[model samples]
Target chain A: MPSSSSVPFDYSADGFAVRDDVTSIHRVSWEKIARAGSHWTGPQRVEIARQARAARAARNDPPWSRDALPGAEGRLPETAVEAARTIGADAHRIDRAWAESMIEALGDAAYVELGSIVVTVSALDAFGEALGRGHEPLPDAIEDGTPDGARLDAATDIGAYIPMADPFPGPNVGRALSLVPEANTLFFSNVMAMYGGPSGSFFDLKWDGPLSRPQAELLAARVSALNECFY
Target chain B: MPAGEQIVGFGEAVVRGSEDLPAAREALRQALGEAGFLEACGIAGIFNGLVRNADFSGIPLDDAALHSSEDFRDKLGLNDFSGAKNSDLSRADASQAGEGLFPHKGQ
Candidate 1:
């Protein structure tokens, strides 16, 4: 991983007016991913990110026709690789039974963390691709540490795939990764930086960025439709 | 709403990563200017992850959102999505309208 001191991202050369706040948050996210998380180690988290990218690369292929991911190169197990692949490539098809099976094998917290990594990388990759910049490179070195195995005590089964922080005043989508606070934090950082209004508030219904709220929502709705996401 | 059509076209092209993205990107840039085009790209990118997070987590639509959206969910063909199974749409209160999306904000 780039040392904590190294700048992880610099969009200045991209020539487009990338927001400073957006750049800073992405750097922070990369820093966090390079370090150990609540469940997975730095190397394992990076590996999950790589696998997610690989899955996305093969998104057009049927799962059976895609080349198999290598076996257990990093600390991650084969099941972890599959979890990343499914969540990364075919999340629309993910159902309660498949999620339960993954959770049963990987444990709920680990599964949530893995899913968070997959989705976060997906967002980052998509951002670059949209900007015609392709993907930002994965971290060069993995920080050294073990999984903390920590989880929030307040989380409960909310009738979703796994437990989430309950009584959350925000939308269910906002609390989706609450089972693992780090994962939730990691992903939402990108959400806020990328989509939040000038004050970095997602609830700013009247948000008028360079793109008007309607324009932004139009794009968002179209993207969601393309992804086949109901929520 | 100015460039609404181009924004939708650009978003679709980006998300689908289609062969025509270059053409779509140029058209959106011409319609919305550089700042708007870049912002649109950013929004498109993030929603890709946001949608996955919701689907993989199996979280349902919040009650108010589920209800508020009743008028157009079917019209939009959203009900046909696989993730629609996660929410019990039958439980929505159709009588309730204009319930702001975050009905429980701060409380």
Candidate 2:
């Protein structure tokens, strides 16, 4: 079998009408996430993430979407969950074993690590955008070295792939993704990155062994598929 | 995942399960696509972790109420924290206090 990249050859340009189906899925996922729990911030925020993950396990679908979720109505969506049904979420990506392994590797402590990753990635994104527009990075969105702490390093080594929008473009920060049509012609590029990205990890994977390029992509694909992320 | 168990349950229902499991599940598939359910579940998980970790240690309600919530105190420029007092052991049991964290002290 080809790497994880070898598989998941669906959602092509002509088929989907856009290149970045993956990115679009990610964008929609975030939007739904933001809207799903607008009031939450801080520690409770972490719990919300956990619930989603557990739910994903319970709702196991064939081709995991990672972004998809069953709406208040129940079934998965025929199209994109965000545009039509606000609460609609899809299926999960990996087998129960993978989920269990992930949980085992990173527990609540992973949440803390994820919190930093989310903020760091977002901050880095803002900083990257600002720099892209040619300006000094703002205080509101700096990596603060905190982003590059031990937790992040450990995460990066594992191959979870959790990149953030850094303040200033650097060796670590590459071209960040955005679903805004004006910017990325590829709608689901983010999903693509998340699903089967070749670049180094955005977040670190706790488990480590010998993983081929396809394996990495497949893992990400498993997650995206599980999320039910349709752009 | 919202702090209160009620809200958390509500969220769990919507994201994880659904009000009507069969119909809701189907609709979720059609609307969000295959990843819709999975994504929602993952989102829920992501949010659960994001919120839990951020507030797990619990910021002082007073400080939390304020607009600013610096990771660390003004005095200490570190994100790490140290609790001042121990939780009163007289609190309710796990079943009684409800599995959730208390209003203050010892989450």
Query: Which stretches of candidate 1 lie above 4 Å from their native place?
Result: A1-7, A68-74, A204-206
Error of 1 at A76 (Å): 1.3
lDDT of 1 by residue, B1-95 (tens): 68887888888888888898888899999998888777887898899999999999999888887888888999999999989999999987778
Clashes of each: 2, 134
Error of 2 at B96 (Å): 34
Best by lDDT: 1
lDDT of 2 by residue, B63-104 (tens): 121213232223442222221111122231333323222223
| CAPRI tier of model 1 | high
Best by TM-score: 1
Worst 10 residues of 2 chain A by lDDT: A130-139
lDDT (tens digit, per residue) of candidate 2 on A1-231: 111232232223212221243334444434332221222222222333333333324333443454444442322122212211111112112222332343354342332333332322222222122112111111121111222112222222111222222231221112121111111212123422332223423333222222333433333333222233210
lDDT of each: 0.85, 0.27
TM accuracy, model 2: 0.22
